[model samples]
Target: MYNFIENKNTDGVVFFTIPSFEKTKLVKHGFSSKIGGVSKGSYESLNLGFKTNDLKENVENNYKKITKALDLSIQNLVFSDQVHKDHIKIVTKKDCGKGIIKESDIKEIDALITNEKNVALTTVFADCVPIFLLDPVKKVIALAHAGWRGTALKIAKKTVEKMIQVYQTNPKDCLAAIGPSIGRCCYEVDEGVIKEFNKEFTNVDEFVFSKGNGKYMLDLWKANQSTLKEIGLLERNITISNICSMCNSEIFFSYRKDEGITGRMAAIIELE
Candidate 1:
């Protein structure tokens, strides 16, 4: 249902763009992949995260690689510090280049929504979900980072509500894409996490499955998708990559697959 087109630039970096949003002409968006980069060791290549031990120069180059591929400006990017919360920051021209070049971080923000042109909103991911929303009619877009905690807080739903409050966006006119993350097959959780999800979502049974070992596998992709649909995004307009990071570690970074020390991938959206 989602069109994630893979393109390899001359630098050999593999990045993905949404074909659905590509037609807008007003914005450009894409997700980074594991392929193509300058970092070494566990980072290998294409790690856009700077918080890690990966050389600052390598991470910067990785960002440059993607900007070159997507025809975006690395300097115009605004990043989410991603505390796994539902907090949303409204982006504007003043916030451009905050997390990339001008400043180091935008503290405590997990989602970024913007209507301003050339201000690319970015959020990192490993096993957690990345929700991308675009309201073409309103010329607004949001990038949400939904870890299990953020999912329980219903970050996806919060993003939609924020768009409504800020841009007066109608959810029906929005396009949502749940990007690659750990799938139900590998995201096993204990009772504590299960309790959290149950507390926030009444229809938890729809996405939570029993593993029969005092553990449950949570389908965050489905959880976030349900959040979008419940908020009025058409089922047809929402797409799931269904690509599990744990399973495709070669092509994508996976927190679980790499055991807590791995490179990072980013979901980036920019208004033209």
Candidate 2:
């Protein structure tokens, strides 16, 4: 039920933005796609992941292009460590550029939250769900990288809870989006992952589909949406992109579809 508007800048950098967040005029946010960048071969273009085998120089250039296109300050952007954990970091001005322009001491953080203006928070993805959260009332924005591990740990809920505890954010006043990722149609997992999901979620069947032979297809969008609603986010306020990265590898990066040799897209947001 979530619709994302795609936009192409004059530089040919394609990104997606949520209409709900766009209408608020409280934040500047965008999700990067594979359609733009300087990287070549497997990376092709718009590969934002620094850890990938793509040349570090090309990755840096991609950041510059995307930050400019999204109107985000590359120098002020703080990125998540993204070890698939539920750890959340409260970002400040001093924390700017820790993960990009400078050395980062922000370790093991899968999510980032900030109420400071112009301090963009970013997290990378390749077939992993990117959860964007905005507390319009508090002028706070958060970006979470929820891979299967993070989703099983309820990282989305932890992010909202951290905002509540730190920024006095009310969940009902927040807007959330489950960004593009591998959908159930292509995300097949074994019992090991299913066990983790079962421990954290009660209504597992609603999002987990069986494919026989002990295989299951997990719907991270649904799981994250349910997590947000359980913590008081209104159903109408949460947007599920429903865009499958694996199914649309042309514009999006999918680790599964690319056989573990793909680039990464980024989900970024900042309070304006």
- Local distance difference test, per candidate? 0.88, 0.93
Per-residue CA lDDT of model 2 for 46-144, tens digit only, reads 999999999999999999999999987799889889898999999999999987889999999999999999899999999999999999998899999
Off by over 4 Å in 1: 1-3
Clashes of each: 0, 0
Among all windows of 10 consecutive residues in model 1, the one with the lowest summed lDDT is 1-10
Candidate 2, position 96, lDDT: 94
Structural similarity to truth (TM-score) of each candidate: 0.97, 0.98
Residue 155 of model 2, lDDT score: 92
The per-residue C-alpha lDDT of model 1 at residue 84 equals 82
